[model samples]
Target: MSALPVIDIHTGAAPVLRETVLEFDQVAVQLGGRQILSPTSLKIGRGEFITIIGPSGCGKTTLLRAAAGFVRPEGGAVLRQGRLVGGPSREVAFVFQDYAHALLPWRTVQGNVELALEAAQVPATERAPRAQQVLQTVGLAAHAAKFPAQLSGGMQQRVQIARCLAQQPELMMMDEPFGALDAMTREGLQDELARLVRETGLTVLFVTHDLEEAIYLADRVVALRANPTAERPSLARVIDVNLPRPREQLATKEHPEFLRLRRELYGYLGHGHG
Candidate 1:
């Protein structure tokens, strides 16, 4: 008997040179005497939105961290734009789930965003316009002068996102960014993120435990299994979302494909108990 073929869900658009923005070549990780991730191989094309979903301790965030060069894999390699990733770079921006801690409380919204540009050493004269432009993109232009403590949870997250955008990164690593928000806020931010990614053509690798959220925003969803072995690898499945774009929170979730994907992924994560 032979092993089953790995399912690849593609949007059906041919990529030029099939350009790969990120690749994990048989990557493996161990942390504090535990195997966090087994050897896994994956590729992300330029401008593609790839979401990672799995049960707790399944290495979703670890994978994202490896891509960001925050974690070193014990075996194999991670590549960005075909070059070996050494450490964190300006070209890759990370958005944490805790927006409260991620944003500097004392800094005004614009001031916080300005930090990215300042780190990149953009001339002082050019920083404000760039920050404002990104703030406008994320619908935070009007709140530029407000402090993080003055804003709601969702708006604070937007400020963090705006700061990342100010860096003009080619790739964004988001770890459960909307996980802390209320349902309505999460849905709104999902749509907003989808729009921004479309407009900017930025490649993203998002981590989430929410199956529906994974299917909703991803061009492709990568499902992982925690305890990987030779027979059952860490990369359990790769599902392509064929749902229509500009997805609506109400209508899109009601779509047949959406329901089917939700059910399929639920089996992997055992989602119905709660």
Candidate 2:
């Protein structure tokens, strides 16, 4: 393992020293004779907004899935609150890229949000109000009775977000949640997501291919190296963002600091603008 720098944010809570919420300990993943991830390691503190960015085959999504318990690491470990992640925990929620497959068509927006609570066997009397509150947070409470087909692509994604939120998950793992939407819609949802994270103090691990999106949303951007199985593997890099909090669409993107950070991230990804 390379010498990695650690950053700490004190939450002033006892029983936990420094509050290391999620830790990936030298994780190496292999699938189908291919090295999906190579001895990767990272530590995310509570309430952090971490964005993972990398090239297509660099295992960004795979890492997220592993964190969500969909895949296991061949080496190293995935930990949540100092415990090894054996399976899907109630505290970790996943939002997939494809909303169509993630949500059931037969279930209404509200129903989709309530499915997790239902599986947990939350009392029926409390499900509606909980579901409604989350939907409202995603700006979809009015569309509760509507089905996925009745909403736009953005709205469907909102439902997905609402569904995850209703679980009251302390950790949210989102894999390119807005990649399928139009630019305007993507930006709109991005703002909404930032708001939700701030309001709920959700610890987010978001994966995206878009550098601008990464810079705009993340407190730190972790860039993955090239495929480890490749003839020559690149180096993994992490860029710390010092931008001030409470990011908005226009103000954040247009800020001089945002551009500088974006440029640095692109450079770390081996991209340079002429």
Candidate 3:
């Protein structure tokens, strides 16, 4: 098998060939009379898989939502391809954790995927083929006629992912997408998602509480802290996962670098740091 075109981000050198697709320039968010996310700054390169991991209420979801233009920031700005993102666009796709609720019960897998193209005003003649293509990409072409209720949890999540792919978004914002699945299913979906990202070169911003998951999926992990003050800001630390691509659950976890990263990030969570 040919090697996947994975970016060598752990080299600690700037990737001059890659372009910055999303940028958060001192972005801050406030909710319900309290600051949810303190001014945070980061640049996401095209095709970068960035995972945001922190404590339960560290505004990880808020940061992802802000990037999707669902939450308005109280300060600073979010830029997409050098342009400021004022509102949601088709270029940005969001995947929620609750796959059960995210998919329409009335619609079949293919129909649900069609909704994305329909919303984008894709020609009626082009919807079916596009939907089927994405379904096949996610390994769900055989189950396209099945409804969300009829499919398993992992299959239902694949439908949601296919729908996102149908939209052909430049950036994918996923909020704990695999959190609801069982351990084995979660690992399967992780490998599948990594493969999809490698094939499509999609830039993803995923939020999760699982440290191992973060280390496994991310090129760089951003750890956030809640209730930020000037002394202790929301952006805690950003760690580079230097492990090579095509990571396996058994072999990759046993690697020395992965062990060191796991140990390093373990201290950031549940250690009164966040």
Candidate 4:
């Protein structure tokens, strides 16, 4: 077998066309004789944050999974660093929509994060410190010994993120990770997640139903077509967000470029121009 490809995320110093990290070449997916994703194509550059938005059942999550090797397509290819992906490799980590199912009920927050490292075959002696470091990164250091039952919903999701961070995967695939949280908590974690991505230089492929969330977090947003199983899902044009980095939620949202991007993103999802 050939070596699994390792994708490099661009840190914004060079032009996008010169540093394409992830590419989809006329990719299509189907299940039970019904088409899920249409002939979609995109190239995600290194260090770029991409958010995918659409109505429910629009194959946004499926496309993210395909890139993570969870959903293999019936046609076309997903290339990482210009090489085809065959299966689940260590280079990718997926944060599921359901945090309750994603975390282990019996494991403490630290143990859960440690388990990810163990599964990745990280040595036993190195696991504790690695887990602790990631927990710090996600701002869950105090809850290390606490079980999932002891923490609130948002904290549990942080533990989930810490686990993924512990693995230190090259490409992070998130499927509505904050969808289940309340408004305040959701906003807080959204900022935290953006900070983590920027500080750690991790490339993200996030799937969300919220257009505002897409505008706030993504360097570019890709909108999907609705009713994926009934008809092939399509990719609307990529909306570029060139807002200033290290963005604050309130300030970034208030910016003119942010509003313009939000409006364009909404329109792509079949909303209005005004």
Pick by TM-score: which candidate is best?
3
Clashing pairs in 1: none
lDDT (10s digit) by residue, model 3, range 129-189: 9999999999999998988999999999999999999999999999999999999999999
What TM-score do all the candidates reach, one by one?
A: 0.92, 0.90, 0.93, 0.90
- Candidate 4 Cα deviation (angstroms), residue 61: 1.0
lDDT leader: 3
lDDT of each model, Cα atoms only?
0.88, 0.83, 0.89, 0.83
Prediction-by-prediction clash tally: 0, 0, 0, 4
Candidate 4 lDDT (Cα, 0 to 1): 0.83
Candidate 1 runs further than 4 Å off: 1-17, 229-231, 272-274
> lDDT tens string, model 4, 1-274?
1222222223435343435667888888896887889888888877679999887777788899889888888889999888898789878999987888999999999999998899899999999999999999888899899999999999999999899888888889999999999989999999999888878878899988888888889888888877654244477567777777777889989999989887776666675211
Candidate 2 residues 1-274, lDDT tens each? 1222334323323333336788898877788967888787788877788998888877888898888888998888998888899888889999988999999999999999999889778999999999998888888888999999999999999999988888889899999999999999999998899888988889999988888899888878888876575444322777777666677778888999899988777776776211
Model 3 poorest ten-residue lDDT run: 1-10
Residue pairs in candidate 3 whose N, alpha carbon or C atoms collide under 3 angstroms: none
Output the TM-score of candidate 3.
0.93
